[model samples]
Target chain A: DARVTQTPRHKVTEMGQEVTMRCQPILGHNTVFWYRQTMMQGLELLAYFRNRAPLDDSGMPKDRFSAEMPDATLATLKIQPSEPRDSAVYFCASGLTADGKGAADTQYFGPGTRLTVL
Target chain B: DQQVKQNSPSLSVQEGRISILNCDYTNSMFDYFLWYKKYPAEGPTFLISISSIKDKNEDGRFTVFLNKSAKHLSLHIVPSQPGDSAVYFCASGYKAAGNKLTFGGGTRVLVKP
Candidate 1:
């Protein structure tokens, strides 16, 4: 019954404040992903990591957003100078692709962190 | 531009009926497609997936059909139940693209009991 776990299930912050969201991927899962879900844009991939290494962060806004996996079990997404537009439910997902498996084959998601910038 | 799209914003179906959700992708390079179900306040969960090499895949009451030529795919749920009500998202990606998944705007399904 292992599942991805995200902390601070709900966050309310003022504009220009810094926010950090954390996730603990399922044990032994080798890949991690961060996504933002908004009413206007639906769900967007913000960043991803494989084997504790960042593979792509192109979807993330470099100026204000940063994602890192300090270790296999812990991953974090930080937003500096958070704005109202940055308010959205952030999700963390993890999967195993150790044996030449397709990256999108399967993923398990954690209960998302709902961020609100007022 | 959105690479994956789910045109229908919402769908209503009677219990015991069949619910069909459609998805389309613009990327010809996409070789894998997946369907996920999300409840309010919860993260999306993987439901079913199909490979471009195969036209269809079925698990229990859930079935996914893929038409490569049309660049379209669909999820069919037979004997739909109240628990099946949720927002359904379709995602697509290619093997070469790594683990990043491009998700479509979800289609919310309401099953009336």
Candidate 2:
């Protein structure tokens, strides 16, 4: 089965450290998304890419968080000078852009990377 | 503001019984809704979905009911099995709004076999 793959299923890092999470979207999928899930905030969209170009990153912390799709198969989410508040399960999802439009997007999520910031 | 809400944090149901999970949304622009099931340490898996144009949609043992007027939708799993025990999340989306899904906090369902 074609599935989104994520790296470092679990990670523990100290505050102020740099954390990087990688994802391999399902082959042929054209859109990728990054999300953060916490007990208090639920699920929040951190960033998204369409055709390997960022469509939105408004939900991310502009100063410390960045997301990129270095190639068709790889997408990455990075946090610099990470803080305790950044500790959460980060999920990566990919979907096909139906009919060349943004409609009918059905996302399939990866196993998610659990980040623990001490 | 939380656009989607799953008020019940958890529920328990006997095997072979019907398990109903409810969700409500405050966003009037949402045109599509979906249900997802998640196991511990796993990503949410797609369960079922309903569009605003239709009040009901079904797939096998799962059914999704939508009440657009009330901004509420529900997932019904008939003849619940032990494998149905998982966290359920409700997500809402607007096709015109880039299809970005807004998800609820999720409800944990336990099926006693």
Best by DockQ: 1
Q: Give DockQ: model 2.
A: 0.67
For model 1, the stretches where C-alpha displacement exceeds 4 angstroms are: A100-102
TM-score of 2: 0.97
For model 1, how does the per-residue alpha-carbon lDDT over B61-88 read when each residue is reduced to its tens digit? 9999999999999999998999999999
Model 1 has an lDDT value of 0.94
Q: How many angstroms is residue A74 displaced in model 2 relative to the true structure, after the best TM-score fit?
A: 0.8
Q: Report the error of model 2 at residue A28, Å.
A: 1.1
TM-score of chain A of each: 0.96, 0.98
Give the docking tier of candidate 2. Answer: medium
- Any residue pairs clashing in model 2, and if so which? none
Model 2 / residue A12 / CA error / Å: 0.9
Residue A104 of model 2, lDDT score: 50
What is the alpha-carbon lDDT for the whole of candidate 2? 0.92
Candidate 2 off by > 4 Å:
none
Per-residue alpha-carbon lDDT of candidate 1 for residues A1-118, written as tens digits (9 for 90 to 100): 9999999999999999999999999999889999999999999999989899989999999999999999999999999999999999999999888464445568889999999999
Winner by lDDT: 1
Looking at candidate 2 chain A, the ten consecutive residues that score lowest on lDDT are: A97-106
Cα-based lDDT for every prediction:
0.94, 0.92
